[model samples]
Target: MTATISGWSAIVSPRYLGATVTLCLGVALLAFNGFLVSTALPTAVAELGGVALLSWATTVFLVFAIMGGAGAALLKERLGARMALIAAASVFLLGSLIAAIAGSMPELLVGRALQGLGEGIVAAICYALIPELFPSSLVPKVFGAESVVWALAAFGGPVLSGGLTETLSWRAAFAVNLPIGAIFIALVLLIVPRGIRSKAEGRLPIVRLLLIGAAIMAVSVGGLLDSPVLTGLCLALAAATLWSVIVRDRTAATPLFPTHAFRLDDVVGAGLWVILLMPLAQAGSAVFLVYALQNIFAFGPTLAGMVGAVMAITWSIVAILVAGVSDATRPRLIRIGPMLLVAGLGLLAVALAMGQLPLVILSQVLIGASYGASWAYTSQTIMEAARPGERDRASALLPTIQSAGYGIGAAVAGLIANSAGIAAASTPEALTGVLVMTFALCAGLSLPAVWAALAMTRR
Candidate 1:
């Protein structure tokens, strides 16, 4: 049985408030960075001139984020939480500074890679720190606070980041991170004790990291190739390389994933598949959305950002609404999420073809609602289905796997859009046709997620 707590005062009290604020601030930094990049990249492209390499910016960051996350626990063990956080914040600050002063897309990507590494380590460490900083009873409250931070970021990020991009140079958006990072570090110093250090078990899979990196780069450049045969070969190579990672990791000395991973016949495996594939399909909106809104519809940065923000708002509200859903009914919600993703993506294609803004907004609602309705339940299924000893490892893999999906998905979207002439789409009609094809491919990617989600409903 769980311990009893009458109210949230135990968490909100002055004793713990600074620590609480630091945790929330960490979440804010990551959330704001994501929304800001999505909203401002179009502007950055206008100034920096890399429309062809647009998706590469995001793909690069996600790849490094995954890499950094893989090593977070090791950092904490070696450095302790206080020093670990300080170092992470410093890295993030350096990345932001580099990005602010960047003159070209390639240089900006270098900054983004560093930004990804810093943010990735910080995100993972924040989760690990929860148990260390709070009593078991208060841990739930800490997580609850984190969820609120995410919701607030979803609501405010577009507004804040969009305004920064419009009123100042796009550089100002990255500059905003500097102050936030400073505050996070200050509070971390004042609040967190020097955590105990221990020897970390196992080494990072350097070979696997390289393999995934190569695969992402392959997909990122695949669409840019002039010849159809070369493009096809590149994509095939990416798929095969990714498959090999999964295949080889199962038997590795230091396994990258749990033993049951990717086994469709196993429930946890099904849940993991759903996690990976969902973001893969959803990356289309993250990559192409602002450009389409700005170029085709002539939306200002703030307005275009708001259009994307609606999805996050819808997701937060829907997730809260469904939190109380009976266990008996939760599986049904899990089953519906990916199906809605497929439908929402399909609708985006239809909206682009029909040239309808209202339809686009409606599709966004469906996509957001799908995640809100299903993500928690799907995660619960995976955790519940895991072998007893694998629970913590299963939990750690979720975010990393989700990042894998987005990184790979962004690369694939690049391939598809470039193949459809996104690199040279100067006219509204040309851009529209390319987006239509891109979303259609996203919809197809979403179909496999439906099967994975369906597997979660089974025994």
Candidate 2:
């Protein structure tokens, strides 16, 4: 262990316990909202009688979140972290209220969109604030603690969603956020000291931000549209809009993302690679597993959900353990993490081919552990590499790559399954074949991440 790690390990004493809890609660609220929505979304769609639009709810939030995260970085530069957090919390509260009271699907979506904006800003600020608040030696440990909160949120999110939907209503799930958001905002103001205000870099263009947000919303909502051709066109427009943003950023005096991020430094590039590959490997396998378990094994929704939770629980546990270790050895852990992921995915492919459920579940456990450790390591690595002031800009790209990778992976898997004579509805043989192909692709994509990890040490 390095001196830095040893110091951080010692800093988690009784005196700073209050500050630590406050920080964890604030970050956990953001993640709880994210996970809760995913759990309750199915029920929401069923009630609204628009099952086709189910995916839109998740996609739209992510799209808007990208824009919000970028904007928050800029806002933090102007208003300072403390004030920026206040603004984000307010927006989140209002959005939660809107979601809870919404009468129609469109209205509910509007609320969700607003919530996404708040989520994006708050998430970026959280990453940006960690380095500023904690000593350099303790930053990684703080981030690791945050990851534990995220894991808890991920584990608890679905269970809460299921319980809320079954007992009360889906509306209750959104309503729950109001009180939590309020409490967190209060705690942040009371606990965190106000620092020097951030020096502004002129003003951000509101019109440009709107254009980006609109383009993302169109892509997500379009996907929900029944017309296949229209959906394709919308996706094309989204792509063009993103490309324009990239071009503009290259030339702009103050870009939304830092210039070097796109240039791909060893740590940043490794972070991006993990962001892309982990999601692809995890999500693709997940969709396939859900199908195989429910169709092949004839499991109920409750049972299937429990099986899914196993992966998340194991991932969280591994992340916490690895994060607590010393920084000098962290780099090696990063390398091993991705390699294990690739190996786990490969094993899953073989298990699928052999028609063995036990083997498949075991593969999931390994993959989950790899994912947990990789996520924590990558997050810490990116924070370590970024310039002090540009942390938010760099961190914003991580989520964007993750969301994009998962979407692309799921779509590609769907196409492959359909083309291979598997109908949309699941069957034992068809699902088994889909799992085989999906795992194979995930294993292959993970190879590049391994290479990226190797490159990190050399740099």
Candidate 3:
């Protein structure tokens, strides 16, 4: 009999329960880890002495994560789902141990990169497992379960992580990942089959991967530079490298992105721009939101983490509400989302200037809700808009592009803050001024993103 997605009961039924929990665990591991790290990293930096390298915390993880996600399919093909999952979990566990024991900023970053690589693959594999393990009718339920996981992580992850950091230490926060990863591996052994491996087509795109990595590194290094002229040169080099990679990939037998990947005139291209810019715009907030709250509001770690989570919490709730909207309304949402982001960032900038807490809260809600209201419709539209031949590649590339956007955005925001003298700022007012620049940059990105959203919807 086909599994029915009639109610929550079916998902929780004994027959489906273990598999459901496993899949959801994979997602939860990734989401919860991200929130935990975000909330705890500031403290980690304080202990480790990498004040200037703060943004690299996010930049390095995201860069490595994009690479991991892109390579997941091939990994699965070689190792089988069972082994692949165990390997991923083991790597994540190892990373947690390294991070937990780290005595320096560089050590923490290495651990973070390993964690990103492992978790990225785990999440991707979980997505692949969904279709195989559940009937078509139940796929929605599986995804719905994941949304709840994300929501819970957003709502409570920061507070829990912050509490752990406060009571124990920043290292304690990382140690939480150890047991979770072990359980994940155990579940994989119990539930996943050994014969799941298969021959895969195409070698990994080593050259393209290198180009992407180099570009991100350039952007990140540029952000750390003291000289504005040198920063501009680094940005230019990064851009040129990215463009060259895309151009080269268009003709690759195993192209990383479609031929029309970033073409503004094409639907997938415009939609891809929105994917890239949306996260890129939000990255500053991701990297700096908690820190800003701590500085300006004098909030405790727990409180600052909760405030930082408002955006994600709002986004998750709103996304669920908008999941089943009509096609007619989705197009409107595509435009509305970016516009809301613009408004959110603008309000945040002003709120910081005026030291208005309520306004700051409102801005976070608007920005998080913006993504919930629009991201799904935006993604569906982009997938549907792609030419038949390029459709699959375009769709697969969306998440990866979004990851790249965040990495690049963090680099840009870090650069802006460093250039604005955040390192030298001794008071909350000075820090606020520097953070405002990042918010303003996000607001500025809205123009092109909204334009692209409009363009994509028309297709």
Candidate 4:
């Protein structure tokens, strides 16, 4: 039954109901955990007394998650979707339990790494399975609904974690993951088909995996340290290692990213650039924006979270509504989307300079809505450009690139702020100056996205 997607209806249609929920849960779990942990980590650090190792929680999780994403195709081939998801959920459950009962920072870090592995694998699987399970016409709808899950988690994760930490204990936050994991396992077993598994080909790329991990670690560790010379050295080393890995992959018989992925003129390449740059631009200030809200605007945690969520909330609603756009309108929307992102960021920079909270919130909504309007189409473009056997690899590319951009962006942003004296400034005037500088720089990043979108149009 190839039903034309008129709206969100395609997702809720009888044939897709089970698959829809299953896919949504796979991603929602990842998103929820990310936000929840960020909110609850302060309390955990306070209790465990590992303030110095605080950044390691996020750094370890991200590095392992990227590793999981890179190896996802192999896992799927070896275990099949049903078993793969089950394994991921079980690992996630174990990690949650370990973290919940952890006595020290090291123990929690180990548990976080495990959770990252599971989360990354599940996220990659969600993308890979979409093409396999759904009709082409309905794929956008599935992506839209998945974005909604992400948006909901963005809002809900912080609130739930904050409430739990304040009212109960930070341990209670991790305990909640138990039920979600259980439900995810049940849904996968019942709804997802046990498809025939193919023979796993090739040994795991041990050397390439090591290179990727080293690069991420070097950059991450470098970013955390206050020494400029060390940060520069680490960041440079990370760049060289990343470059070598990409070059090696390109020449290999089985590459992680297809050859087209590296080309600027190709559809997949353009879409991939859009994916990378959007996050790069946003990450430059996304973390700072939260603090700015509380520090400069004097918003409470709940209120600041709501303002912070404006982008995601608008993203979900816009994505849902735009799922029904006509074919002709999609191209125009795609082109305009990056420009809207530019506008949104620009407005945000202006809002920060003027100290207007409402404008700040409005800018976030525009930025989020721009993503909602553009991402599905860009993602589709990437998949469409992939060779038949390469779609699984393509599925993993967007998220990997996006995550890398985020990590790198935040690191760069910190350097920018530190250099500008924002890191040491105590006055509200100094805080605003740093934000203005940071966001203005971030806003400029959208120009490359515009260029990428234009490149896609030429093709």
Candidate 5:
């Protein structure tokens, strides 16, 4: 099969089109859930009476997502991608239903956990399938197109969430996933062709997998708990479990994460840096921005939602522009992306300090642009670095790391905000301090990416 094709031709190809659309729909659903919940969550917690467990709503999903993603190769090896995807979609749908009707905080968390599992599996498989479905030359364009789907989901989700909450109930936010999930499942069944299944797997280490999952869950849920003692203990246990897993995986015939994935070489190093820091800079700041607008600027839910939408739009535009130029000079684009991110976050921080809501909104445009360029370049760089056969595993690992990073960043930020008493303070001073901290974190994260990009360009 040819590895290179023109962008226009790739888009029109029947196989490529089918796979892209199916993957886009699946990813869009995931993005929509993430975006909608961010807007609706404050209200959800108020109604559910579990402000303590608030962060769990996001962190739990991320923890399971990493575990599910890590286990995806094992599952796909045992059950084929087609079956794996179907199972994931079904579980996601079930989770959505549970969350939609959850009577208590625990039930809602349970639903979120299930959804996270499904999301992880689906995301890993979708990424793994990309190289198989498209030629090498077409991968960038196809992946770039997928970014558009994510952007749309991000842009529309907040608006929809705000409107739905105003017109109906916050539970209705989850209800939106039902139809999307059903359609994604249907399309995958009808369009995705059966391919050669993986044959190189021993029995899955159920105990180790469970340990890893529990460790991730502990850290995620622990971060949300009000008790610092419990959170610290859970984090310690999580660290221990991770250390044990690393040791065991080294000796195991088959491991959850590929052994070579951790290599600190140029391409792999750059890819991992992007994976870890993108969320730290992007999603982490997003949490702060949303709260800052609501609490400090006195923006209603609808206006805050609109600000987020603008960010998403800018992200899409930058992604497309970067994709168009990627073939000619990927390393250069990668280098510049991080600098843009740093500048954006700097502007955002200054705006918050000055109590300028309008300026803050403009800063989001900068953030969005940086996110777009960096995300596309990072993904392509990772794909390029992997061995041909290992692409699936590499792709699967990307999202797992991304989700894990987001969870860690948010959890850490939450701890800081909570400890400083910023989360509860109704005053603008507290809000500004929190926003400043978030921006500082984002800016700090971007600096490393800048160095990574420069290193890549030098090569």
Candidate 6:
């Protein structure tokens, strides 16, 4: 049965207030930081002079973040939730400081890597901490609140970063992280308790971790290099490494994932596939849309940011609304969710082809709503599907899968864009065609996600 709490009142009730604040701020910091950096990167590169290395600024953060997420459960077990958060915030602060003062591209990348690592740790811990901190009924509410915070980030981060970049300096965006991290740390020390440990104290899966990390890095690096041959090789390497991890884990005494995590017939496996494919499709569309808006439509950074905000806004709204839905209804929502995504992408393809700004924005809203409705349930399903001892790992897997999916998806999208002549397009018409192809490609990719979601309903 779902928790009895109704409406938004449950989140602010005395029993859950402190946990609610801490969780929201912890997650908000990560989301805000991501959008802030994306907004600031262009100005940062212009000032620092590493135009060619632009992608690395984002890639390094994601790769290490995935690594940190992979180890979050172990970190929490050894350090406790309070201390784990403290450590994460501290590292994040240090990274922000480094980026703030960086004089070169290399220095900025180092700072970004730290930021990613700390953010990864924080993201993993936040998801894992939810079950421990909140009642079963409120878990969905908490995740819904996370979507709200992310929406806030989407709305606020770009505008704020753009203002700072234009008026003061790009470095100011990085500087803002200092105060946010400090506040998160203070909240942790005050509201959260100490000495919470994991049920499974098994040793870290070093080999599997390395393999996954390599796969993420390979695909990310593949995105940066424009060579068709090199991209193909890197993707192949990434695929091989991932297969090895699955094969290796199948026989291990302590497997990284539960057995059902790899089986399509099981809810856990189906949920993971949904997690993987959704981000893959969304990120790909996002990359293409942002490029098309700015380059082809001549939209300013702030306007483009507002356009991007449509997704988060709808997502947040739907997440909250879906929280009140009954358990029996969620399965149907999950099955229908990807179809909505497919439909949204189809609209996006038309919008890009016609260069209609209103339609593009509407498509984003629909896509976001579809994602929000399903994500609330998919997240809850993953946690509930875990065996007793595997909850932490299950929680950690959600973000890990998400990060890996984005990295791979973005890389693959870049390849598709390049193949479609986006980089060499000489006119607006050529750019429009490229975007149409790209969105169409992304839409096609979501078909398998629909299959995955439907598989969850199987016996």
Measured against the true structure, the TM-scores of the candidates, in listed sequence, are: 0.80, 0.87, 0.82, 0.95, 0.87, 0.94
By TM-score, the candidates rank as: 4, 6, 2, 5, 3, 1
TM-score of 5: 0.87
Residue 157 of candidate 1: its Cα lDDT?
72
Q: Please write out the lDDT profile of model 6 over residues 1-459, one tens digit for every residue.
A: 123365567778887888899988888877999889998998999989989888888888988888888778778777887899899889989999999999999999999999988989888888887888886677878989999899988888888998999999999999999988898899899887886665665677887877777899999989877786788789999999888888888787657665677578888888889989988887777777776788879988667767877888999888888887877888888887888899898899999888788999899988998888898788778788888777877787788888888888888888888888877898989988887888889889888999998887664
TM-score of 3: 0.82
Index of the highest-TM-score prediction: 4
Cα error, residue 200 of model 1, in Å, equals: 5.2
Pick the winner on lDDT between candidates 1 and 3.
Answer: 1
Candidate 1 lDDT by residue in tens digits, 354-381: 9999999999999988888888677666
Which residue pairs clash in candidate 5?
3-136
Error of 1 at 236 (Å): 2.7
Candidate 2: lDDT over CA atoms?
0.71
Clashing pairs in 2: none
Q: Can you give the lDDT of residue 269 in candidate 3?
A: 87
Cα lDDT tens digits, model 5, 162-205, are: 89988998899988888989999888898766666777757878
* TM value for model 4: 0.95
- Model 5: weakest 10-residue lDDT segment is 1-10
- In model 4, the Cα lDDT at residue 73 comes to 68
Error of 1 at 158 (Å): 5.0
5 or 6, greater by TM-score = 6
Error of 2 at 40 (Å): 2.8
**Which portions of model 1 show Cα errors greater than 4 Å?**
1-22, 37-59, 73-86, 100-110, 127-155, 158-172, 186-202, 223-231, 294-301, 383-389, 418-434
lDDT of 4 by residue, 286-325 (tens): 7788888988888887888778888888888888788767
lDDT of 2 by residue, 269-317 (tens): 5566666666765666766776677787788877776676667777767
In model 5, what lDDT does residue 23 have?
79
> How high is the lDDT of residue 16 in model 4?
78
